[model samples]
Target: MDHRLSPAATARFILLLAIVLFLGGCRFLPWRSSPAPRPGHGLQDGKTAGHGEEPRIVFEEPDLPQPAGEVATPARKRACGSPPPPGRRLPQVAIIIDDMGYHRRIGGQLLNLDMELTFSFLPGAPFTPELEEHAYQLGRDILVHLPMEAKDPKWDPGPGKLLLSYSPERLRTTVRKDLAAVPHAIGANNHMGSRFTEDRRAMRTVLGELKKRDFFFIDSYTTAASTGMEEAAALGMKTGRRNVFLDNVHSRDKICNQIGQLIALAEKRGWAIGIGHPNQATLEALTRCRKRLLRQVRVVGVHNLVR
Candidate 1:
């Protein structure tokens, strides 16, 4: 108990104690990361529904496919919405732009055109109010492009489409509701009524309602079998039939060519009606063909051609 260590031995003992202290103080590095993920499972991307609840799996949506083509310019954007500047009737021609309200830029571009054209809006669309207001501000003639059943078995005519399955009363109610949706709507046209427009009974029910409201009808003539115009006339409601589909092919060349034909027809018959969509191709065609259209015949609103 009283034995003293030699100086060298004591020095060696102290060095050993320092080495132990330094080794014991050092642990894992500060920059060390967590454990590697287990195979086939991640660190739960989802949270528990509540306390003591199992976590639910969260899925990230796959990217949707892009549309086939991008429309740089709308197919038609004719300067629209008025009659020939007073005293210039000049064998009127009216262009009607259908399928409005779905696309914002196209609709606005169509409105921007300085020509007098009609805009037919789709009721119940998300942009219905905005489109109606813009068209209204520009004093454009607004028409409700009423959706109707087509001959195709699988084609979806979209919301508010008229079905042959509807009874007369049901049809009337639906028509009224649609017409009311677009304030200042002077008339309506069928969206795709190849089958419904051909049924005389259905046309009568539809025409009868239009007659009651003093609204005009424009038969899109989606099919040659359509009797929509005849029934409207039978009911004594003012009506018009599509003379030419301006952009059936949805190309600038085809649409402009169609517009040329429309002008010639207008000169011959005193009036012509052309229907087109709010597309880049149609817009380009109409814009390019503006001067020729003005010289060949007067471009008037759809209402001017109703008679």
Candidate 2:
């Protein structure tokens, strides 16, 4: 209340004013921490977004239909390959187990299924050579799972991948090396070419190399924007596009449903190709569905479907 205060009082007032001012100014600071997102809010599916971070986009091709619900599996796994009833011309469906060579045990199990499942080997995977040889011996159709740049950089397609920035020569060289890594490969398919396959020029370069070797191309069709199937056809190369992705969900029920979907698609279109991974769920699903599959349609090699 006095005009002037003692030093102690003045010091106390100054300190209080300073503390208030500091607290008030914090709201204007550029680095103010954001409130943590409530659980089940903000970032989802274990994805993060920070400065300069592009939001992730997960693409599901239109052809890949999600299952309505969990499919019921039988207690006893019925034998899969019962020769199609005589005199019935069943539609052909090709099942390609992609991402092979990495999972030796699962791949071996898949090979034993007697479904004539095609095996697509990753060129740089450690078990590729041995598994490729084994698949060849088993008379399974082989494909080079050619790595290519995915739309999401977070998804690594593995080594020796063809990129959109590559020169034609570089793309050709990389493709050749990738194909060489897998012996007995009658053709090649995109492992994850969401981005690379969308670039027509780049795809032409990659497909051109495959054309020279007389190898077919199967577009995994990771993206709807992909020009791989179109470009390959324009080059007069035998080509097929995947109709269904069998195990994107990795549930045995889901995969069995997808296989059912694949067979239905083939019956409608005369032929259909379903691509899956060397996953245990997929192997089990195929084994479980074997009899129903053989009875419904002819399971052929992927090469047979590519045209």
Best by TM-score: 2
Q: Tens-digit lDDT track for model 1 on 1-307? A: 8699999999999999999987777764464455533321221222223454322211111121111221122224323223346666678888999877665666688888989989998776656789889889899888998878767644445567688999999999988887888877889998767778889998898778778778999987777677888888888888888877777676898877778667656756688788888778988988887876786577788888775
Q: 295 in model 1: Cα distance from truth in Å?
A: 1.8
Best by lDDT: 2
Estimate, for each residue in 276-304, the C-alpha lDDT of model 2 and write its tens digit: 88766887898888878888788899888
Q: Clash pairs of candidate 2? A: 80-290, 80-291
CA lDDT, every prediction? 0.73, 0.76
Query: Which regions of candidate 2 deviate over 4 angstroms?
Result: 1-86
Q: Per-residue lDDT for 26 in model 1?
A: 75
Candidate 1: Cα lDDT at 248: 65
Error of 1 at 242 (Å): 0.5
Q: Each model's number of backbone clashes?
A: 19, 2
